[model samples]
Target: MRIESESAKNQWVTAAFECMLDGGLRNIRIEALARALGVTKGSFYHHFANRAELVRAAVERWELEGTDAIIALANREGAPAERLHRLLGVIAGSSAQQGRGELMLFLEASDEGVGDAVARVTGRRIAYVAQLLEEHGVPSGLAQRRAVMAVAEYHGARVIAAGTDSLPVDERVLDVGDAIRFLETTLLAP
Candidate 1:
């Protein structure tokens, strides 16, 4: 569409993502988003063909935000370890609600309509991690293994952080960054 219209579309997609993060898929109603945006359902319809289309757009946006933008930043910096450190730091600062919302998105990705897009994003992550490891002088096979381990580490850390209430989840998240840093130093160091 027109440039101005595209901005509205982007705003709607961003609002849908926020809805997902705040309250899962159930919170992504047109009326709710319209109210949050100080607009009307007609505005949402103008941007999206239907609710499913909106959901797809939101997921696509989230995937790009989580992967592509971060990768671009890492590549631009030319310091793999430091880039990864910053990435993990961002992850560690995320709220428990965000972790839950991410888990929900992963589950929803299993649906037939969304599966390919999610899988593509995930595969891209693994490949990117493997490349990073390889650049550290790791053999290809080992790099691939370590890449998977890295992803597992992130997921495991989030799972652990989510399951505990004895300490604040944000406090637990600090351990995740520390744990990943340990892996970087001991296992992934060049």
Candidate 2:
């Protein structure tokens, strides 16, 4: 059952991500991850040097797979507001990116290494949002402020959406227009 190769590294990282979602980083023990994946430490060490390396790799992978992917989504197709709206559309509790997992990841930002990664992701998201706003003649400071606010609201909306426990994740589409209007349009309003 052991798949020996770089794919093993990816499997380990993916397992680590799921473990982190289950109980944050502390639950991501090598033995436990192996148990969860039905692998062994031998399989793990074949990919990562140690637990710390695994943790680092997990965060990097999450950064690339989550925030970077979202930013890339935002950068594609349509105007800034439309792009932002599309980004919000998928996150409105419809995806893994929209629930307790992300909150846990944000909470884990206190960890030194993870903190740097978290900051990098958050800053990139805000900077990208701000860039879109700035493109519309919004002042730099206001654009930045709105961008931060937008992110906060985005998370808050997800919390509320997920809290209901009634809507299927895919059905939890928070209105992207609200975000676009507040974050993008209002700034452009004369």
Candidate 3:
């Protein structure tokens, strides 16, 4: 079941994402993907040269889609506080969907051969967040720090969320918001 066209490449990428979300990236194998799509390994190769290529595509899609959504929300013309709230919302929402386990898998993948590529996309996301902070008149240095802190806190929240079945949604959201606010006030303040 060789993938016949560019559309088929997209289908393979979609299947790969579903597989990763279901069982993490380690479980994403060419044969498994092909079987899942009712296609042959050759079909996958027709679209992606190999598993690495497919993984790169998946990471690109994740960053592009997630970053785009966050940027759109954060860019809404509003008070600085409102913009920050919306930015936090984007982080919380995306983290909730990704969960801790999936993120750990992604982080591990990021350290492998795919690290540079993932870093490039992730750098863009961070820059976008920093840009929003700067738009609100945050100093350049402080904006950079806050942007990095925001990313770190988001990842930390995912870890915390994953560990406790008893963790309430409000608690997690509050924790995330508090961290963002603290950064905004302390780091981004003049």
Clashes of each: 0, 0, 3
lDDT of 3 by residue, 89-118 (tens): 666655444664357555667554667655
TM-score of each: 0.83, 0.78, 0.76
Best by TM-score: 1
Evaluated at residue 138, the lDDT of candidate 3 is 82
Error of 3 at 156 (Å): 1.0
Model 3: which ten-residue window has the lowest total lDDT?
A: 93-102
What is the per-residue lDDT of model 2 for residues 1-190, given as tens digits with 9 covering 90 to 100?
Answer: 3555758788889888876665566767898778777787788888778887887777787788777887787678887667766666655434544356667777765772578888888888888878887876678998888889877876776566546467653343545555556644554443
lDDT of 1 by residue, 103-177 (tens): 667766666267777788778878888887787678899888888887777666667666657755566346655
Ranking by TM-score: 1, 2, 3
Report the Cα lDDT for residue 101, model 3.
33
Q: Rank by lDDT, highest first.
A: 1, 2, 3
Residue 149, candidate 2: how far off, in angstroms?
Answer: 0.6
Off by more than 4 A, model 1: 1-6, 164-177
Once fitted onto the true fold, the runs of candidate 3 whose alpha carbons sit more than 4 angstroms away are 1-6, 95-97, 164-190
Look at candidate 2 and tell me the lDDT of residue 130.
Answer: 83
The whole-model lDDT of each prediction reads 0.73, 0.71, 0.69
lDDT of 2: 0.71
